[model samples]
Target: MTRALSAFLVLFGLIAPALAAPQNKDGDSAEAIDLLTQASKAVRRETYRGIIVYLRQGDVDTLKVVHRYYDHEEQERLISMSGQVREVIRKGDKVTSILPDHELVLVSEHPPKSMLGGMSHFSPKRLKANYQVVDLGTARTAGRDCRVIAIRPRDKFRYGYKMLIDSKTQLPLKLNLLHHGKRLEQMMFTDIAFPDHIPDSEFVPSYDVHGFRIVRHQAVHVSESASDKREEQWHATNLPPGFKLAEDGVRQLTSDASVRQMLFTDGVATVSAFIAPAGLRAPLKGATRMGAVHAYGDIVDDTQITVVGEVPAITARRIAQNLVQEKNTAKKAPAAND
Candidate 1:
């Protein structure tokens, strides 16, 4: 896949899953949940500037970020301080990615979510059912005292996380993505400052883009007739325990092609399945990994199925294998709501 397509898939497929929470038996469940709750809120409510280091697949990239919350909305800017010169600016649901190296700009509507720094707001009752939350004592990051908390998966289907939350602001100063007790990705802030005010100009793009190619991704609208037909054509036969289909729809990928997307979540971890015509492009027939994200692809009934998530390889492979085209006209269960 091209770099732009890979980035789009990561945004729409991998990072878009919702989380469900359960109770923890290993540590103080109430304290763990409360701390997580606070950290989640701080990510959205606090306005700060920081320098963050991201480590993935033995590669490190640094970023400078400025975020502000005003009028109940979020405005943030992130600029790469290493490797390629790229920038991401978000104002609420609209996100613009600037690639200086490619002279390209991608604009899309994305929910405010993060795989590295932000915490998903989840139900404690639901979260406790799938994972064990524990207080792992104290640690220090960015010269500030922090509380270490671990959210370990109850099974091997999903990944786990270790977070260092700032003692005063409740912001996450460090985060580690774990799989099978091994670190897959890590992000930590080396310096951060909470500012009283961040001007609007701070969120503007730093690079000039007078001749850059801008690509806008708009939501596709399928008619009721087409939607009903698709509902009878494909469905997932088996879902992992605690997982449920959260969202499914047809998305326009090009003028002549569209793909059906299904999002599944077990409250904390999420996976996404995409189905398209086998001839849409070259089919991916195996597994691939990029840091904590795992993707599996296969062909079913001449249709292409690809599953991607921040879950284990087995989880993605199982999800892809279970997505089958219906041989009969039997109606399937509707997707669940978050």
Candidate 2:
């Protein structure tokens, strides 16, 4: 029975490795989640200053930002190197978009939905549903130990991404848009630091110009209705991995006089489609690719459909081409009175 005992031991050894793998995976996942949670909280709590660069197809500009936060209130000052110095101070959803050129501050209620806000959307639970997040070892960035996580899309309706988060603070040090396993776009922190004390005066605007124009814009609200729900009657039979119907509405565009608006999101990225009745001008044909943004215009019957998104070119084209209108009535339907 010695041979039998040896065979049993071999089987046990093989099973042990398999059993241990799941526990290891669980541990890694928990650590990643913890990092993400802490980073989200840190962004809202910490105050500092640094230089940030926005890179896209046609435009490249570096800007300096100084932010101060206290009592759940934040004041931010932004200076553009290429253009005039502009300052924006935001308290909650209300923001003042300052323009030094006109010496005016335009008030708006949106958060500018910037790269910082985009990073804020990286919630561990919401992201886990659409992406398979795994730590791809570790590396040093900006003098910090960064744990790299590859967010692989589960479907073709969306693209994939990779993010590097600081091991100690959990803040994202780098973000990359992946295409076919390669980076199509990337945002990396050239230099970063967390300071304990930020001067309050730095948060205030620098210039004072008399007789400046102050333009205040109102916030647009989205409502749920049959017309809004059936705005384009659009359904994408094929989409890149991870995309879903994020929003839809009816609105008029300058190019087209008709009212139509549709929004789609793949959690991380979003695309807005606007359709309307064609103007008196002839139908236009062509496509334009602008950095991360792609715009496509086509005529569906007499309706002009335009699709814009920060996704790839092909994705924008496919979505614009698939625009359709659904009829409201069936053949010989009974009247409500009957």
Best by TM-score: 1
TM-score of 2: 0.69
- lDDT value for candidate 1? 0.72
Best by lDDT: 1
Off by over 4 Å in 1: 1-28, 111-125, 220-223, 230-232, 328-338
Model 2 per-residue lDDT tens digits across residues 1-338: 11111111121222112222221332335455455555545555566667655554445556666655677675666666555566666666677667877778788674444212233333333344555556687988767789876656655545676767778766566666676786665655567777887877776667674578888764433434435655446544355444555555543333434355676655555677776677645565558875556788887666777888766776777777655566522322321210
lDDT tens digits by residue: candidate 1, 56-155? 8899888888888899987878888888888998887787999989999999774443222233433345555677778898999999999998878888
Every candidate's lDDT = 0.72, 0.56
